[model samples]
Target: MKPSIITTLIIILFGLFTVQVNHRHLSRLRLIEVSLNKTAAGLGISRNSPTSMPKASYSSRSRQRHADPEVDIRQLANNLIEMVKMIPESESPKDRGELMNSLATLSEFSPSQIKSLLSEIHKSDGIDDELRKSVMGIVLILASDQNPRAGLDLVISSHDPNGSLMWEDAIINNALRSFANSDPAGALKWIEDNREVHPEVGQKENLEIALLGIAREQPGTAIQWLKNIDPSDRDDLAAKIAKNALSNEQRMAILEEINSSFVTSLDTTEMGKLKESVMAGLGASLDPDDFEGSTAWLENSDFSPEEISTITSGLALKNPCANTGEWISWMVSHLPDEALPNQVTKSFSTWTNNDYKTAGEWLESATDNAAKVPAISAYVSQIVFVKPQTAEKWALQLPEGPIRNSALKRIASVMESIYPGSEDAFKQRHGL
Candidate 1:
C-alpha cells in the first residue's frame, strides 16, 4: 500500500501538537509530494524512501484547570448502580474477557451511559491490565463529546500512570478536536492558559493544533498566530491550513499572510506542497459538467489549458520544484484526456531540452502508453534537432497511427535539408 502524503504532514504536526510522539513515525522520511501515479507499472517514487521532535512528559505537578460543566451526580450514580446489576458473568474467563474488550470499543453511548459502561468494565473479573487500558482509552475519546472538560478530567483520573502514554496523547488530541469544533477561539485560549500545566503537553506544541483549528474558522486571526510559530515550521503549516479554507479567495488570503515565500525560499518538500496547491487550483477550475460547462469554466479561470501548460512547464523546467513524471500523471488524471495531450506535450519538450536522461528514461519506462503519445512525439521532435536518427528510433516504435505519423513527420521535417522529398515520402508511406 502507498504511504499517505497527508501522514507525512501529520507527523510534523503531531510533534508540534503533542507529547508521546512515536519515534518510528517521526524517523520515517516521507516525501511531501507523493507520486499519485503509483500503479503496477511502478509509476511513483520508491516505497521504501519517505521522510520528529521532543515531547512533554507527564508532570506530576500538572493540575486540571478547566471547570467541568454541571452534571447530575444523582443520575450518574443511578446509572452506575443499574450498570453494576447488568454486568455479565461467565464460567469461561476468556468469554468474559472478550465481552469486556468489545465494551471498550463501544461508540454510541451518552456521557453518562459511557461512564456507567466504563464502571461496569472495571469490575468485570478476568480482564487484564491491557484490556483495561483499552477501556480507559475509549473513556478518554468519549469524554470530549459531552462536557469536554469534565470528560477529560474523568479520563485523567482514571488513566493509570504506569500504562501507555500514547493513550493519554490520543485523549489530548481528541479533546482538542472537540474543543476546536465548538469554540476555536476559546480552545486556543484554553491551550494558551493551560497547556503548561503538569501532565498536559507543552504549550507551544499544543498551540499548533489550536491555531490550526482557529485558522479553519477565522483566518484573519489564525494567520497572525500561525505566523508567530517558528519560521521553519510556518510554510507547510500555512499551506495545510489554507487548503482547508472555505473558498479559493479565503485560501489565498490565508496564504498571503504567510511570512515565508512558498515559491522562492522553501525546501523541495514544502515547494512540492505548493506545486500541489497550484495543481489543485487547476483541478478545481476543471469542474464543469458538460462541454459548455468547460467553456464557462474557461471564462472563470486564470486562462485556458495552453496558458496553464506553459506556466507549469516553465516552473517544472526552471525551479524543478516538483516531480516531472508526477506532473505528467497529474495532467492525465485531472484534465480532460483529449485536452491534456497538447498542453503536457509542451512540458515534455521543455523537460527533454533541460534534462534528457531523466525525461527520456521516464518516457521509456512509463506504462500509460496511451497518454505517452503526445509526450513521446514532443520529445522525438525536440530530439530530431540534435539527433534525427535517434528521433526516428523513437518514432518507429510508436503504434501505427496518428502519433506515429506525427513523430515521423517531425523527423521528416528535420531531414528536409538532406533529402528534399523526405517529408512527402513519409506522409505517403504513413497514409497521412
Candidate 2:
C-alpha cells in the first residue's frame, strides 16, 4: 500500500512540531521537508548504482514513467536512515511518522530500486538499531498492504542474524491487519498454509489481530470465518469483538451486525456470554455527562434484568469512585429483588477491592437501610478471603435478617477453611 494520507499528515505535522523544538535541528528538518516537496528529489540525490540489488517488480506504469532515470537507491536509503536518526531519542510518534512518509518517496523508484533501497539500509553499517527497525517496520506495513505474502517474506528476511525479528509484535499486528483489510480470506489462508513453517503466525494474538481487522473491514463474513477457527480461539475472539464494539460509532455498527451473527451462529450459553461482553463494553463506553440519556436508552431496550445488571456493574467497575450509595439505590429501584443481591454483591466486591477504606466508610455511614443490608452482605463476602477477621466484624454489623444469616454463614465457611477447628468456636461466639 502507498504511504497513508495519515502518514503524509504526520510528516507535515512533524515538521511543524520540530520547527518549534530546537534551532539546531531546524536546518535538517527543513532539508527533509524540501526533499519531500520534490517527489524526484529522493532518487536524484546520487548517480552511483547500488550493487547486489534484489530482483523485484514495479508496476509497468511507474516503469514506463521513470525509465532509465539517473538515480541512486543508496542515496534514497541514506536519506531515510538520516531522517530516522534525526528524530530525538525521546521524540514522539510524530518524528517516526515523518520517517514513514518518506517511504512514500519509494513510489518514484522501480520495485528493484525500492528493494535496493531497503537492502542498502539493511546492510548499511553504523546505523542506529532503532532507525533500522523503524525503517523496516514502515516497509513491512507498506508491503503488507500491497501483498501479505510479500509482507510475510519481508518479515522473515528482516530477522536479525540471531533469528529474532525486531519489533515483532508491532510488525505482526500491522502486517496481519493490513493483510486482513485488503484480503481477509487470503490473509487467513496464508496463515493456515504457512502455520507449520511459521507457527508464530497462527498464534492466538496474531490470529486475533487478523480477525479483528476483518471484523472492522468486512464484518459481514467475520462470524462465519470465526466459527471455522478452533473452538477456544473462536470464543476468545468473539468476546473481544463484542467488547471492542462500543469503542467508536463505526465499530458500534459492527457490534450490532456481529450480535445478530452471534444469535444465529452461537449456542445459548455462548450467546449469553457474548451479550454480557457487549453490555460490559457498553457499560465502559458510558460517559458521565450522558448518563441519563444512556439510562433512558437502556430502560427502553428489551434487555433482560441480568444484562441490565451486568451493564450497571460494568459502569461501576469502570469508575469505582462513583457514588456507591446512589448506584445501589438506582439498582434497587430498577432491578428485581432476585437480581439485586447478586448485582449488589458483585458491584460492592469490585468497589471494596479497589478502595476498601472508602467503601467501608460509606457502608458504615449509609442511611439507606434498603441499600446497606445487601451492600454490607456483599462487602463481607468479598473481604473474607483477604481479611477474615474484618469480614467477621462486618458480617456481625448486618441487620438481623436472612441477608445477615447468609453473610455469617459465608464467613463461617471461609474462616473455618482458613483456620481449621475454628468454625464451631466462631459460630458459638457469634451466637449463630
lDDT of 2 by residue, 21-46 (tens): 32322332332333233422332322
lDDT, candidate 2, residue 111? 47
Error of 1 at 156 (Å): 4.9
Most lDDT-accurate candidate: 2
Best prediction by TM-score = 2
Which whole-number lDDT from 0 to 100 does residue 349 have in model 1?
Answer: 82
Residue 116, model 1: lDDT of 55
**Candidate 1: where is the Cα deviation over 4 Å?**
1-132, 153-162, 197-212, 228-233, 259-432
Taking all chains together, each candidate's TM-score versus the true structure is: 0.40, 0.51
As a whole number from 0 to 100, the lDDT of residue 420 in candidate 2 is: 89
Candidate 1 lDDT, 124-194, residue by residue in tens: 56545554554355444434544555555556555554665225665665566566667778767766655
**C-alpha displacement of 343 in model 1, angstroms?**
8.2
Worst 10 residues of 1 by lDDT: 28-37
